[model samples]
Target: MNTKLPKLEPITSEWMFKFINNYELQESLFKSYESPINIHSLDAFSRNIKEYQEILATYNFNSKIFFARKANKFQNLITAAVANGIGVDTASYEELKQCIDLQVSSDKLISTAAIKSRKLLELAIKNKVLLVIDNQDELDQVAQIAREYNIKAKIGIRISGFYYEGNKLLSRFGFDIDDIENLLQNYFTEANEHLFNIEGFHFHLDGYSTSQRGESIHQTLDLIENLNSSKTSFKFIDIGGGILMNYLRHQNEWNLFKTELQDAVLENREPLTYNNDGLGYTNRNGQIEGDLATYPYYNENSKASFLKEILDTTNDSSKAVYQRLEQLNIELRLEPGRSLLNQVGITAARVAHRKVDARGNHLIGLEMNMSQMKSSSADFLLDPFVSYNNPIKEAEPVEVYFTGAYCLERDILLKRKIELPQLPEIGDTIIFVNTAGYMMHFFETEAHLFKRAQNLSVLGRKEHYTFDDFKTE
Candidate 1:
């Protein structure tokens, strides 16, 4: 391992440690399932769910946690979520259909697709799953489908234009809160009541800000209060998920990385990332500019404590947000995709080849593609474990970049240059910890006719897991 590098070591689960340490098992699986493989554990996922449940219990508020299915496409995790007394939040027709096929109850399935299609609306109406209407067109389609089915389709109106800290949060989705009066007067008419059952108000924000969440809840609460009457009422507030989760083990490491990255971008030090790409920073005439585009991998408060911070936010009347929900008998609903999958999965791939680029940089090729382990972030910051297949000989330390199987020049697996005590031999396994959320399959593809990585759900201890314990995809 390179001790001189500003390292962001991962805070891994016991399952990850056990699995990565077992070279024999990893090698056997690689041989069986091909090079790159994704392994998941329900233990961490279930534990995360219980933590949220426990925290909500402390507030004495009726809460619902829906596992956002868009984060990962693993069906086993969806089934596991329903079994744990939670629900599934799907964003597409196939996701909703698969959940229903898995026999998830109507109350435990919700459709929050950004672009709702007629087929999706029909399925959601038939299954009675709550469909969050984004705009008037979508609401009209859903209403028409409900009328065709001769049933009241359960619905939640997605609200946007929430004011946070003096700025109106802009988003293309959802109806403007300023137009709520007009919306209620026109679209939500008495005739529409027979075609729609307004269950609640829903909103999804982009960034992670506790204050913004608090302000949104306060605003939504005001809307529900003003709109509630003999004719209509809301039972829940679905805050679509942006809950943060910590990945790195040390805050100082993340801090040092930022400083070093700025120095590298300013030409004060050697390149930290491959080609000194700066992740998201730019050298603007001897000054670094642009915000870091990666996820905040090191958080002091996350998961349950993160939720607690929002619930503890006080309204204008000095009542806590949770207290308001409790007094109003409102269900505080969240669709957390990444946080619930924290520490739940890892990606493993085999070393393919090694070479030196024209720029004199060392490159080690892996059997996996960049899309197999990628997200919207500029790069994944956690360091990976190299499971060497052979014994260590007298070797010198080397710093190299990991490359992927794609033919494109931008197919670098990890932007940061990794330092190792020695160069890995062919067939050595490189394991990326805590990748179950958006890293493993969010943007994966089958380009170049390369088969997609296989997924396996594992159970039991490292020493006790058998082939039979794996739920294959």
Candidate 2:
């Protein structure tokens, strides 16, 4: 399928309604969870995983995918990932402990975050986790901790990649590539028998730039070789992340929702009947008139296909570009944050209040907050899931602005102008689609005292259950 998006819907209708509708999965939040919510968006994590496995096949790269736990703080997400062959990335001691409690092997869990506490350090030393060292300070600290725990562990350097144009190129989390003081050379070079294990190198690019990622892997290998000086000890170079997911053909960019709330001033009107006899209805695009024989096909190809393509390109280019740094020598590592869990989760909340301002503006207040999501912008900032049960037809419509219950003026979620069947009631649930990525349900804003959104999971093919039962052991 074309990677580019089609004529976009104002909201994520494809995942919000189409996918859920076909599966016949019902949301249970309507009665118990909170008020004003009757059946909200359901499990996004479960839905995405089955799709991501397909994306992985696209690349033919079988690198272990360690799901970045910070992306979504859901235990069910961790459960789903552990169930798959993929691993988990935890930066904190508690998260690491949770990983162990969840039964993930120490080799599969890598400590990637730069900052760490004494407790976190102790666990890493005791558990023998793949500690990704950042700089001299961190490297020294790791050495001290390892000595204290006396564990013969593996270590990897967070190497800087110079792909970005300017000084922004040096990774904030990794050692400066220009700085020869990387752990391998400075700490382990003169040691009698490997002061540190010196596993390999790792680096992560922020956005979805393929060339930047390719160059990052290439540069990491170069940095590793230059530092080791023909005496390479380790066998892994973590590319870190950037495994794209396949979220069906229709719903690609879930965050592109835009809402125009300024003009929303809801006005109730009389209900009317539809012309079911094909009186005013017309198939302008022949959409309703097509048969399955002529309709375009749906591609369920695996996500691995894309990874393999990039991996092949990187591996192929490395031979001529950086001949000494073997391409197939080091084990490829990845921490797929969103790609592994994007389709497996969704967020559901209730609409609390609705009103029209003095200038004829319609407003909807939901119980969910924007900060709950790791994304900078609110859902529908690029695309929203608009309420389709609007009373006013498109030919004659009034726009509505959606907001959250918080006191701040920035609490708005959706600004898409649309006609609605009265503002969402105190009990109506508004679900956010495809929130299984970085937006998983753990941002219980302490600033606002917003309880962490309750996370739920679908067991096997039938049981729909809550996440509280699967807490840290």
Candidate 3:
């Protein structure tokens, strides 16, 4: 059956397109580093940073962009981000220590780890990097560590339970917004102020809604104002990252795919996804229920514009969020992970085998595992670039699902069935672009003792690019 699949072509950077088109370079790198290698471009990363900085520079309020380190674990990118005049938002002891060891100044780093250990607290206090406390337990831990070191640990309290449009948004990460004032009154007394220095408030919302975020900002501002006093003055409000970034080139394609997916789920058409996976859609008594659970891949307003929208969010009665920040001289801080790493890296893997599965579905086996390129989304929706080992040979068009190295039955690399001009041969290269954010190394593992993919940072794209141009540990 010849199937016509919807294409989600990704927006690529110059370096990414160059590397994708360079078959010789890919062959050479795969030959040297073996199959399943991730290549990142520092230049693309820096350019993304500059875009955000330029957008923020237009505003009057002081601002800082902290690169969330949990997005990608590359040390090179972390150091490069700080060198570009941004801070690093470390989430763990290792993440914090690495930044400190790299000589990242205390001001350029913040520890926002969900679970803070004693050692993590000690390290953050020693380095004087801001620690975003989740609860009173964390606060007490920081206080103990500060007393031991005889220095106040600068910290921020994370607030949640934001009410937007008369509904409260719930999150397990931070203190409830309603109780923040009470918590402050109890903990941040004049005597206890010496133990912990309150820097500001922080929050991370799940979805990409500008109005909700703007309302969140208004609520946080109100809390800051209510709690403002002689011993307490907030300097910044961190609307933590969940900034949207566009991935697909066409909106019609995304729309069509969604329609087709629903139809496929309802058994009204052929399955677009492997095994007719619902992807959060369910047939509840012959009616479609639940929305697509995947990331909204086709964003109309993303990155800087998305941020601007949030800042410009205000009703007629109140000032814009940014204007209020300007009036109060509050530094607007954001920690962007995926958007910052946009077009910065791609993961390449060689085809290991091609076969027909038990259910008569064509499966292309890749050298890598699902975790190597997996995200929290239902699927990585973008079409992969293929580098055929032999393009001269004539072949038939084939539609196949890419499988991974894991032994489990559900280790399908991509849930979507992709149509190719020809069946991929053994040792052919499959390049998944724009995977630097959470796709590359977020959940990579060594289950069954398979060696992890090597991560190499591509220094520059030149005419005679050699292995020396790629940096690998």
Candidate 4:
């Protein structure tokens, strides 16, 4: 079955180009690896950090950049964040403890986990880490822990303002906006006020809408103003992370592909064979509309530039984001996960076998499991770059789906069919680009007793590629 697919161009850095061009080095590395491997670039990560710092410098107000640690579980990234003097956003008990053990200052760490266990709360209070209280119940727990430990818990309240498609709350992580007054009246009493320090407000949004973000900021600012007479102090606004990353370089192609696919399905043309119907959207007419399962693969603003856009956005006539923060004498804090990790890492797998499926579809099985690259999203849209050690026989190009070594029928690496210059043979390497963020470790497991992929830190330039094992533990 022939179908038109969107051509995706991945964002690449100088180091990535050098690494991809050095096929000999990559082949040698893959041949040595018993399992799939992830190549991380410290240079690329450093460049991303510098970009954030440079953009943040343009604003005149007090701001802090917190690297969301859940983006990737690699310990080197945390070390890099500490070395760069930036803060870390940890969502787990072990994550907070690990950051502290890595020598990261307690003030530079923010624990925003939804359910903070007693052990996590105790650790946060004992270490003086900033806790982003999710709800009144969590606040009570923190207050109790603080009263028990006789230490003031520095905390921020997370607010939920964004709504889903049907005006439903985006997530259960934050308190409803209407409950602000009730929360203040119940918890901000003189008896419990000194037990915890209500330092600021935070909201974690699901999408990357600058206007929505600005609106949230305005709402938070209004809340702070409303609490002017309250006993509790609020000094900052933590707009929790949802910074968009442009994974696809050719966005128009993606849009056009979606339109064409919808038209095809509506016209009763040969349907695009997805592993599951959930991969694409089905309209009321029983026609597949488009692929709604994927994230916004192409965004206008991403990484440091997105932050600049948010800062430049005007929430009111008198104040832009920076102006508002300055006028209120409050700090602006950000926790960016995926955007900060743009072009920092990639996952490479060796082709183990190739065969024609029962439906006449060509399938290339890679040694890596799907869990290694899977995230909460339905499928990773970025195209996998293939490298062949042997020369092609000048045969016609073939479209094939990449599957994993797992025995499960649904263990496909990429749901979409990708056209290769030639059919891949055993030992060829399939490299998925820009996978450093949530793709690397999120949902990763050693299922079927197969060992998890090893992470390698790439160093140096062309002609001399040095590799170091990045310890995950």
Return the top candidate by lDDT. Answer: 1
Residues 313-385, candidate 2, lDDT per residue (tens digit)?
4444344222323444556677777666544555666566778877556777777765554354223322334
Q: What lDDT is obtained when candidate 2 is compared to the true structure? A: 0.54
Runs of candidate 2 with Cα error greater than 4 angstroms are: 1-28, 35-62, 163-168, 181-183, 190-195, 225-229, 244-309, 312-327, 382-397, 415-423, 440-443, 460-473
Local distance difference test scores for all models: 0.89, 0.54, 0.88, 0.79
lDDT per residue (tens digit) for residues 203-275 in model 4: 8887777777876787777788888666666889999888887887787877865665565556544444354
Please, what is the TM-score per model?
A: 0.98, 0.73, 0.97, 0.92
lDDT of 1 by residue, 1-473 (tens): 12367778899887787777778888788878998999999888899999999998888879999999899988789888988999999999999999888889999999999988899999999988999999899888888888887989999999999987788999998999899878988988987889999989999999999888998999999888888854788999999899999999999999999988888888888888987898899999999999889999999989888899999888879988998999888999999999999999999999899999998878999999999999999999999988887747788878889999999989999999888778888888889999999999999999999999999998656665555667785
Expressed as tens digits, the lDDT of each residue in 259-308 for candidate 3 is 88888888877787888898889888777999998888899999999999
Which order, best to worst by TM-score?
1, 3, 4, 2
Residue 356 displacement in candidate 3 (angstroms): 1.5
lDDT of 3 at 114: 92
**Candidate scoring better on TM-score of 3 and 4:** 3
